[model samples]
Target chain A: MTLEIVSPGLSTTIQDLGRPGYFHLGIPEGGAMDRLSLRAANLLVGNPEDAACLEAVFMGPEIRFGADMVVAVAGATMPMTLDGAAVDGWTSFEVKKGQTLKFGFLTEGARLYIAVAGGIDTPPDLGSRATYPIGALGGIEGRAVAAGDVLPVGQGTGKAGRTVAPELRRMPGRPAELRVLPGLYWHRITEAAQESFFADEWTVAAEADRMGYRFKGGRPLEFVEREQPFGAGADPSNIVDGCYSYGSIQVPGGTEPIVLHRDAVSGGGYFTLGAVISADMDLIGQLQPNTPVRFVRVDMEEALAARRDQVAMLDKIRGALA
Target chain B: MAEIQAPVPGTFYHRPAPDQDPYKAAGDAVAAGETIGLVEVMKTFIEVKAEAAGTFKGYVADNESPVTAGAVLAEIDA
Candidate 1:
C-alpha cells in the first residue's frame, strides 16, 4: 500500500524509536520526539511500538490511502478529519482505499504521530528509519516529508487489528512540571542558580524549534570563571565545535538555559548544565510558547524508575492489542 | 594569527548594551578571554570571548543576524 502526501505541514518525517550507540561519532540518535505517543499510535493498530510512523510537527499532512489499512493518530490533539468526519485519537480505524485524511491547526501541543498497520516501508539508515534533517540521514531522503511524497506501507504480518479504549486516550492538557537530571556541568553553576532553575516558572521562548527549546526566566546563571576548565578530550584550551544532543540544557556565558531536542546538533562548546530525563523529553515537545515550565530535579534512581514505568505502560498497551 | 567565533547559535550583537558603543572595532587590540561580541538565544545574552589575544580583524557575520553553531563571527590577528 502507498500513502500520498498532499500537505506535509510545517515539519513531518518518518521516525522510529531512534538510532543509538552513535553519539561518540557526533551523530544524534534522532527519532520520534514523543516516544510515548508514537508507541500508543503504533500499538493501537496492532503494530510493534518501534515500527516507523509519521512524526508530524505543528500540523499534519493531507493523505489518500491506496489500499485498506488500520491507522491510529496520537499526541498533540490537532483537529483531524477522515473523509470529512471527526476521528478520535488513540483508537484504530480502518481506512478504505482512496479515502482522504486531513489535519488542521495544532490545538494543544506541537507534534502528532500517525501510525499505519505494518509500518512505513522506508529504507533504514544506521538501523533506523528516523529522519535527522541536519547532516541529512535516514527516512525519506533524510528530510522532512514534502508535498507529493509517496510513502510505501509495509505488508502486514496478518496480525488481528485492535483499537484503544476511550478511557486510555491521553488527557487533554499541559503538564506543569518537567523532570530533569543534573548533567555533567551541573556543578559549574551556583547553588542559588540551581534553586532558581527549579523554583521559578519559565516560559518557552519563541526561538524554539526541533533543534532546541530556549527558555526565558529566572536570573542569569553566574560561573566562577569565564573559560571552561578542561576535564579531558581536546585540550581544555582548544575550542570544540559540533551540534548538541536532544534534551541537553546548555548554559553559554553564564545565562538562561536552552534545552536541545531531537534535531539538535552533535556537539558544541557551551556547557550542558543538565538533561531532561529521557522519559520527560516528550513533555518538552508539548510545551507552547509562553507556557510555564518548571524543572524538577531527579536522581538517577528516580530517572530509571520513571523509564521503567513508561516501558511497562507501553508494553501493557501492546499486549492489549495482541 | 588566530580567529574568534561565536560559541553557540544565536543573534550576534556588537555591543553589550543597546546604548553602549561597540565593544571593539576593527584593528583594536584585544586580550585573550575578552568579550568581543554577544550571542542572544532566547532571552539569554552570552558574551563570546576571544580564545587568544590578538588584533581585532573583521566580522564574518553581520550584527543582529541569526547564526548557527560554529559559524565564524569574527577574525583576529594573533
Candidate 2:
C-alpha cells in the first residue's frame, strides 16, 4: 500500500521514536517533537509504539490513500476530514482506496501526528525513520514530504474507531509551566538574573520549530564579571563549546532563551542555564508563538519523579488502548 | 461583510516588511486570493489572502499584534 501526497503541508515529515546513541557523533536524537502523541497514534493504529508516523506542524498535508488502511491522528487540535467528511482526531478510522485526507486550520498546539497501521516504510538511516533535515539524514530523501511523493506503507492489521479518551490526553496550559533544573553554566549569571529567569513570564517567539524554541519578552539576563575563557567569545553568555542535551535552554546574548529540541545541534557556544525536565519536553512542542511560559525550578529528585510520572502516564495509555 | 481570519497563530503584519507600505488600506479594492496581510508563525510568514472580491474595510487587528487562529484580522464589504 502507499500514500500519495497531493499537497505537502507547512512542514510534514516522517518520524519515529528517533535514533539514539549518536549524540557523541554530533548527531542529535531527532524524532517526533511530541513523543507521547506519536506513541499514542501508533498504538491506536495497532502499530508498534515507535512505528514511524507523519508529524505535521501548523498545517497538515493533503494525502490520498492508494489502498484501504487504518489511520489515527494525535497531538495538536487540527480538524481533519476524509474525502470532505469531518473526522475525529485521537481516534482510528479506515480510508478506502482513492480516499483523501485533509486538515483545517490549527486552532491549538503546534504539531500533529498522523499514524498509519503499517507505518511509513521508508528506509531507516542509523535505525530511524525520523527526519533530521539539517543533517540530511533519515525519512524520504531526508526532507519534508512534497507533492507527488508516494510513500510506502508496511503491512498491518489495525482496526478502526479506537479512541483515546479526553482525560488520557495531555493538554497544555495557556501559559505553560516548564520545570527547569539549573546546571551547566548557571554560575556564570548573576543571582538577580537567575531569579528573574524563573520569575518573569516569557513568550514563545516565531522562531520555534523542530530544532529549538526561542522565548522572548523575559528580562535580559545579566552575567557575572569574569575573565573571558579561551575559545569562548567576548559575549557574557558565550561559553567554550559544550555538548547540548535535548531540552537544553541556551540564551544567546542573554536576550531570548532557546530550548533545544530533538533536531538541535549536539553542541554550541551559547551558555545553557539549565534544561527543561524530560517530562516537560513534549509539552514545549505543543506551544504556539506568543504563548506565555514560566520556568519552574526543580531539584534532581523532583526531575526524576516527574520522569517516573511520565512513564506511568505512558503505561496508562498502553493499558487503555491494549 | 466578508471577514479575513488568521490561518495560524502568530504576530500579524500589515506590511511586507517594517519599512514598506501596507498591502491594503481602508476602501481599497481587493480581489479574491489577494494578499492582505501576513501571519508570522514558526518564523514562516504566510500571506493572509482575501477569500472573495470586496471593498477593503480596513484591518480589525493591530499590526504586529499576536493573534490566534480564527481571529478576524480584517473585514471586507462583499
Highest DockQ model number: 2
Per-residue lDDT tens digits for candidate 1, residues A73-115, read: 8887777789999887767788889999997656566668899
- Docking quality category of candidate 2 according to DockQ thresholds: medium
* Distance from true location, Cα of A284 in model 1, Å: 1.6
Q: Write the per-residue lDDT of candidate 2 for residues A1-322, one digit (tens) a residue.
A: 9999999887899999999999999899999999999999999999999999999987889999999999999999998899999999999999999999999888888889999999999999999999999888888889998999999999988999998988878957978999999987999999999999999999999999998999999999999999999999999999999989899999999999999999988997999999999999999989988999999999999999999999999899899889
How accurate locally is residue B20 in candidate 2, as Cα lDDT from 0 to 100? 100
Candidate 2: where is the Cα deviation over 4 Å?
none
* Model 1, residue pairs in steric clash: A242-A267, A243-A265, A243-A266, A243-A267, A244-A265, A247-A260
Error of 2 at A98 (Å): 1.5
| Model 1: residues with Cα > 4 Å off, grouped in runs | A157-161, A165-175, A226-246, B1-78
What's the CA error at residue A155 for candidate 1, in Å?
Answer: 1.1
Sequence-dependent TM-score of model 1: 0.74
* Residue-by-residue lDDT tens digits, candidate 2, B11-63: 99999999999999898999999999999987789999999999999999999
Note the Cα lDDT for every prediction shown: 0.76, 0.93
